[model samples]
Target: MICPRCAASLTAKQRNGRMCAQCGKRFALDPAVHGKGMHDIRIRGIAERATDHGRLKITLTQLWYLSRSRNYAWAGRDPQGVPARIRWLVALPVAAALVACAVLTGGVLAVLAGAAACACVVVASSMRHRPGQSPHAQIIPAEQTFRDLMNGSWSAVYGGLPEGVVDDARPVPRPRGANRSGASVPVSPPKAAILCTDRVVALFLTANGIPARLEAVLVEVADADGTKGRPTVLAAALSAIAQYRSGLPVVVLHDADPQGALLAPLIRGAQPDRVVVDAGLPVSAARNRLGVVRLVRHDRLADAEQLRTVAGLPEADAEWLGEGFWSPLAAVTPRVLESIVVRAVERALAAPRPTHHEALTHGFLTWPQAPRSPRTSRAPGTRPPGTGTYKKKGTSSA
Candidate 1:
C-alpha cells in the first residue's frame, strides 16, 4: 500500500502500527488492514467524484455505494465452484487409499475403496466443469460494516468524514411554522414539490438547499419504517400544497424499479388537477450500463404485468424489472442526481396548465405551444384561437 502522506510504497513491516516509516506520518486507513481499495487516497478520490469536485454534497450512504466495485451479484445464481487445488488434494488422497486397499486386500474392501475413489474423481471433475456463477457475490460490504469502518478507523485517522460528505443518519431540521415568541408566522406557498422515494436522496437535496433554492417542498415517500409502498402521506401533503396554490406542480424522483416506475403515474392519478413529472432513474439507464450498481431482492420481486399496466412500460423494461433487478437513485453521482432533479422540477413548473378535464384527458401529452407572432388588429374583447376561452358575466359561448 502507498502511504497517503508521502506516496511511498510501504511494506507491512515498514507500515507497522499504522505509521509510515518513510514519512513518519500516521494514516487513518491502511488498504491491508481495512479492505482492498480502501486507502485514504482512494476514498478521497471517490468522495471528490461523488461530490463533483466539491460542487455538491453527498450523504454517507451515497459515498458508501460509490466506494463499492461496479460488479454485482444477482439472486438465485449459483455460487462460485470449489477451487481445483482443493479438489486435487481430496482426489489424490482417495486414489492413494484405493491403491493401498487393492494391494493389501483383494476383497470387498478394495472394491469399496475403488468405488469411493471413482466417486471422488467424478465429483471433482463435475465441479471443475461447473463454472463459477457469481464470484463477486460478497464484494459489497454490509452497510453496518462500512459505517463502523468509517466511523472508527477513518474518523480516528482523519478526524472526520471526507469533504462534501454528510451523515444521513443525523436528524434533518424541518421548516418551523412558529416564531420563537410563539406567534404564528405566515408562509408563502411553494411553487412546486419534489417527491422523493429515498430518504437519503431527500436528505441530500434538503441538506444542499435545493428545495429552498427552487422554492419547492421536499416530500419523502418512504415512511419512518422505510416502507416504499403507496405514499398516502405524500399524497395528502401534495393535496394540501395544491390547495394552498391551485396549480402547484409535482416532480417525482425514484429508483429504477417496478415500484419507482409506477410512482409518478400513481401520483398523477391521485392528483389529476396537477402536473406530475417523473424524473426517476429509468430502467434503460441502468440496464447493461457499466459503472451502475444493480441490486437484486428476492423478497420484493416485481410484477411485470402490474408495471406494464400501471406504468405503461415497454415489454423489455417490464421484464427486466420483473426479474427483481433494481438500481438505486442514490447510487447515481451526486452532481448527476442533483442535475436530474433540478431539470425535472423546471420541466414540471413549465408544463402547461390545462383545465381539470383537459388534464385528465391529455395528461403529460399536452405540450406548451410556441410563442405566436403579435397580431396587428383583433375584434374587441376577443382573443386569438387556441389561446383560451374568454367569457363575460351572464354570458356563455360555445
Candidate 2:
C-alpha cells in the first residue's frame, strides 16, 4: 500500500513502525470503533453505487496505469543536466585515429592493430555510457493503451452525431448569357404575335401549334396616377393592353379574379373599341377573331352592377380551375382552363393589328381584378415589400 501522507510505497519495517519512510509521517490505528454497524453502513452505500466494489477499485487502479504509461513515454525534466552526447564525441575521434595509424604503417600487422584499437574504443565507449538525468522511465505499452482509450472515446462521440443537420445548400450556378435555367432564349416577339404571361400557357400554345411566347409584355404606362371611378389597379391592366398593341396580341392565363384581368390587356393591345369576348361565344365567332377578352374570369363586369356582383371564390377551387390552362400557373384547378386559353388564342388571332400609337392606346381600359402592389409583382422569383400575404400558393389577406 502507498503511504497516505507521502504517497510512497511502504516497506515492511515502515509498516511495522506505522510511519512513512519518505516523509516520516506517523500513523495509528483507531482503538475505539464507533460500532459494528459502521462497516455495514459503509458497505451498503458502496454496494448501492456499484455492482462490485472490487471491480470499481480495480478500475480506479487504472489511474496508476495511466500515469505510469505516461511516465515511460514522456521524458521528465532532469534535476541536474542532460546526458552527454557520447556517441559522436567518442566514435569520430577513435575512427580518425585508427585510420591515421593504419595509413602511417602499411602492412597486415598495422591494419590488425588499427582494427583492435577500433574494437577497444567501441567497448570503452559502451562501458562509459551515462544514464539519462530524466527522472521518469519510458512507458511504452501503457502510453499506447491510454492513447487507444482516448481515440476510442472520441470515435464514440463523433459517431453519435445526427444526420442531415448540416447541409451544403449552395445556389445552383446558371450559364452565362442565358435565362435563370441556363437555356438560350429569344426576347419578346412583335405586337401582332399571340403571347402569354405564363410559361405553361405558352408551352401549351406552342404544343398546339400556336406561335406564343411567355412573359410577353401586355401593357405599359407612364405612371399609376389617379384616374376616375376605376381602382388604382386599373393602371396595370391598361399597361398590359398597351404592351400587347405595340406588337402582338397576348393570351393572359391567370387566376379567375379581378387582378387576373390585368393580364388581358398585356396580351391584346387596347383597341379603339372596348370589345371583350368570352368562351360563351360560339367557337366560330371566337375563332380567328382578332380582339381581346378577359376570358379567365368566372364572371365579367360590364358595369357597376356587374362589378358589385363579383366575389372571390374558394381558394381550393380557384387554384384547381387555374390548372386547365398551360404553364406557369398562379392557380391550381384543372377545369375549363384549357377552353378559356383556346378562346383567348382564337380571339387574339382574329383581332386587328395596331399600327399607330393612338391606335395602340385607343380602346384601352383597365379592369381591376386583384390590385397587387406594383412592388409585389415587380418580377418573378423576387419578394417585394408588403407582398408577404400573396405567396406562391395564391391566397391574399389584409
Q: Top TM-score: which candidate number?
A: 1
Q: Give the TM-score of candidate 1.
A: 0.69
Q: Which residue pairs of candidate 1 clash? A: none
Per-residue alpha-carbon lDDT of candidate 1 for residues 223-297, written as tens digits (9 for 90 to 100) = 444344445544654554455455778777778877777767766776677787777786765664456677665
Error of 2 at 372 (Å): 36
**Which residue segments of model 1 deviate by more than 4 Å?**
77-139, 172-187, 223-228, 231-246, 354-398
Alpha carbon lDDT of residue 272, candidate 1? 77
The CA lDDT of each predicted structure is 0.68, 0.33
The numbered model that scores best in lDDT is 1
